[model samples]
Target: MAALVPFSLLRNYSPFMLARPFIVKGCNLNFSKSVLPLPCRRLPFSARATHDEQAAAKAAAATADSGAPTIFDKIINKEIPSSIVYEDEKVLAFRDINPQAPVHVLVIPKVRDGLTELAKAEARHGEILGQLLYAARIVAEKEGILDGFRVVLNSGPSACQSVYHLHLHVLGGRQMNWPPG
Candidate 1:
């Protein structure tokens, strides 16, 4: 014989129109009373969101720009907190939020001007461009990776650059392999 569902579960939907019945395999066949297991309680909304979903939401919010102010602006203005390793009048170096290496730092020009990416650079950007590269070396020395390190710039979508503001990635602190994945 089929078991009758409890009134609490039945109240949420039409009992007759329900397609599938809740199956409780190991429980006793007593149907005179209703008892729900502890696991059926509602969970908080945050608990329901997966780690990937939360990361995607953060990435989406960070990349949703129309040539406007970015998180780097806040970092430059000292409005948002960042662990700065090196700073000069022309450039600033700070830790990357999602670091791919043990020692990962981002070197950027304090004044972005119109440089959203390396591809956007012009002849007038030569001075700041050199300054940024020099800052990267200073950062490597400060981080104690002077023996060896790597500098990278993801220019466009093909390179998987999520941030538009131009910046250089300085990575070290381990045996780095050639030809990055």
Candidate 2:
């Protein structure tokens, strides 16, 4: 049989309350208590296996593709759901579905204009390019991380840019390290 412990035994009663106790207040003290069994712990091997599977899934998702109309396109079109931070006629800033930092946001142009990657940027892309940078600043201000923030653009497979569409990553809310991994 399990032991039945009283709630009073868990803590000390206030001396002030004991001294000024009154019965003028009509209150019912009757109550019932119940104990719940602790949940079973998973086996170490099973737990490790589950963790490995999750890591593999995340890696596969992050390194999957490039230069195609990704899920972000759908998000831009309002066909998919995303936590938007800022939006203008030319640009859109939204929270990354998978955050790398406390404040991880992606800022992109509403129109691609064949800017599959930063490497493909031409002299004509100058206007929209400047607009994207300005949008990143707006996003940082809105997220309350204006004091300090980092903007990143992973270009091509070497840089681990899974999505081909041009986008800027704005990250903050923690001490940033130099020479990004």
Best by lDDT: 1
Residue lDDT tens for model 1, 47-108:
45344445654564465446677788889999999999998888999999867566899998
Off by over 4 Å in 2: 1-68
Q: Can you give the TM-score per candidate against the true fold?
A: 0.64, 0.64
lDDT of 2 at 149: 98
Backbone clashes, each candidate = 0, 1
Backbone clash pairs for candidate 1 read none
**lDDT over C-alpha atoms for residue 88 of model 1:** 85
Per-residue lDDT of 36-135 in model 2, one digit per residue for the tens? 2223534333658556655654554464444456667889999998999999999999998867667999999888887867988999999999999999
TM-score of 2: 0.64
Off by over 4 Å in 1: 1-65
